[model samples]
Target: MTSFFATRLAVFSTLLLGGLSTAWLQAGENPDPLGEKTGGSTTVYASGKNAFSFPLASLEDEERTRFVIGNSFFKRNWVEAPASTTARDGLGPHFIARACASCHSLDGRGAPPDWSRTLGPEPDATVALLLRLSVPGKPAAHEGVVPEPNYGDQLNNAAIAGVKPEGRVEITSQSIHGRFADGTPYTLQQPHYRIVDLGYGPMAPDVMISPRIAPQLAGVGLLEAITEADIEGNARAQAAAAGPVKGQVNHVWDAFAKAERVGRFGWKANVASLAHQTAGAFNGDMGITSSLFPQEGCTAVQIDCLAAPSGCPAKGKTDKAGKAPEIDDDTFGQVVFYQAALAPVARRQAKDPQVLRGQALFAQAQCIACHRPSYVTGEGPFPSLTSSKLSRQRIWPYTDLLLHDMGPALADGRPDFQANGQQWKTPPLWGVGLIESVNGHQRLLHDGRANGVLEAILWHGGEAKPAQQKVLKMSLAERQALIKFVESL
Candidate 1:
């Protein structure tokens, strides 16, 4: 190690050896010793590449079979319709990827295309990073957005053999530079996107596009298990406190419940349930239909897409209704179960003094306001599947599960349900540190613009501008400690 690294290691050792007083450590409000179990009993101990792939630790032996089956479907590739493999056929007339794992490799986060390499005429095809497109209009109460007259809600960059893709998504970026209070310079990549090679025609002049990177899937069920009352209470408390971090519940239409419910998933909290989220992904990402989303994601203008054969069962294999979704309820349920039951990997070195000090710095900076620490989950969305494992167990996910204005710097200028252009749902911080280990990349934010945690923090604005300012003013050691503390989560 270099002298600088050796010096850091020595100081870290000293801190671990009680260089900080016991009283001070206790005063900093260290989390529960078992807080390392990020998903409570559902937490997994894996820290390697396969960390995000494990099922809940508390799942019964029989449930493991379901998890295995779900993993298969999640990783399985779908072919175009009229193929021999009818079970997994009917991929897309126009779609982004053939399988869910294409973007969320290993069930972990997806990285954006390399901006430098993407500037060429033949840019890389974006599998994980998709563009959500819409036109300006008064959205119906149940509808969050008016789909662009041409390409529906999202821009698909790939298609089946006989059909042309909607278009290719191109990206380029400029470097943003800034410095800390100590004059330590930093650079951030600010991305610019374009939709080219339109398979159909030009989109509306006022079309809006939002770039979304597929987030990790671990502990999603646990997040769903957090009660509406608890989540709303967070919003109420923030309002009462009169803090700039006031969060609001996003009530969105639920396909499962057939009613408006509190949004719990998505970057904008537009999705209300995991079933809806899962089914929507099946339709939008791979063009595979489920009972929840029976219609294919095709526009009337796209004649090829409209005429494409579905992967539904043969005529003789029809149900009592004389029709069936491409993916039956059983298969869809298995995938949802797999997503809900994937355990958050256990934290590393939570008790280290440097980490604890950093934890204090994180709180002092008021990051805990939005990144709320703990919640005892309730019975999740699927009572039968989640069972008692996720019920009444305290988990430290570090998110408020509410929408806050993230400022223009991070805005996509697209409204999603109740979330305005600047508003974004607070993402959970559990397993954040392990993104590099699990996915071999540290891309963060909805569009994968930030390279790591610090960059993600620096990009913070709107309600979080104060918190960002606090971090900018931190001393080098203090910043390191704060980062170490967040990574330990």
Candidate 2:
């Protein structure tokens, strides 16, 4: 393990040997100014509530026009089938939300539903958090998990007028307490889930349940711009080190590419590209269909869901194959572009003394092992469709985009393709500190259990246990410095 003093000594040697002034180091001036530009030239300096909603500054007039159109579609609510608004009709017979923005408000992190309100409603539907259901068996083609016989892959708590909703999810929390080295107390909330008021007869006897919360959408294009070679290089280096921090790549079947590719999106790295992820969200979350997922989200027993009308008037676009997706390719592509071009917020107070001390502590704890600092992005998977603004840029997303065994406490106990129950992809930390400013909450982790940065740190185990232990041993000042540094990013 690299000691904090050793890292400081190494930095001093490099700066002094390179004939740089020692005063520059003492003043907390970042040697790399590019660090301030979190998403390269694409980065925008917005510290307010709308920080996560900005588009890339490099976008041309035409692209900016498309971005505005796409933003409209993203925030617009979908109506039930056979509505006058043909473009945005055909909402779910069963669904969790009406629009993409319902879950991902202002392109920021999703907070778990308010589980406290129990006065009038029999069961509560979550606006942001949703449960994924599967049974023990081999995965189907393209999709890596075996969908539940009746409920299918996802549980929809809200449905259209004639159809009964699948079920509602209720969450309860138990507090786990711990203390810092200086005897400062800390508390972490552990969330427990329960499904009640089933509309379907019953789920499979041995069904596996995994709860997923929508993540922030900024800087995804830059992550997509990273090459497969570079991602594999991270895995290879970790393996060669023979250290406790072994990161593995998740290779899943890509429906668009018609081949197995490195999974870049989704909580378990289950989805391949931004396009596929967008289409899947439309189909699964809102029961809206596109060319990629033309079929409705109905199992054999869902008679009303199967029979529901999919609205597409004569004015709407249709194909020669008689396949009419609720959303046309043109509108769908616009949403994809908007998502891919949303720039990450620039870092704040990066040179502050307290934040700098925390940064050293961050490295000392070896959180840097999995949360890799930076990468020079490459031409993306769909270079033809994506903007040039995404390519060949230095970015600091603070993730390796590889799955690691996060241990049992954080595990959902549901396996996804190359990711086992105990494993999860390292989520990007670029816009993390600004989640509260944008979304009015600070929920973190896969299930939105952690209330803040310190709570999230306490929840880490397995390969991250050592880092958690290091943090546990740090002084109160050191802990505050670490959190302050993280918040600045």
Give candidate 1's TM-score: 0.91
Candidate 1: RMSD over Cα atoms? 5.7
Cα-based TM-score, every candidate: 0.91, 0.91
- Runs in model 2 with CA error above 4 Å? 1-34, 115-126, 313-321, 382-387
Distance from true location, Cα of 449 in model 1, Å: 0.4
Stretches > 4 Å off in candidate 1: 1-34, 117-127, 314-323
Put down candidate 1 lDDT per residue, 319-384, tens digits, no spaces. 576666788788788888888888888899876778767866776788878988777677766775
Q: Write the residue-wise lDDT of candidate 2 on 273-324 in tens digits.
A: 8888999999998999888888889999999899888867323556676548
Q: Pick the candidate with the highest lDDT.
A: 1
Each candidate's number of clashing pairs is 0, 0
- In Å, residue 90's CA in model 1 sits off its true spot by 1.4
Alpha-carbon local distance difference test for all models: 0.82, 0.81
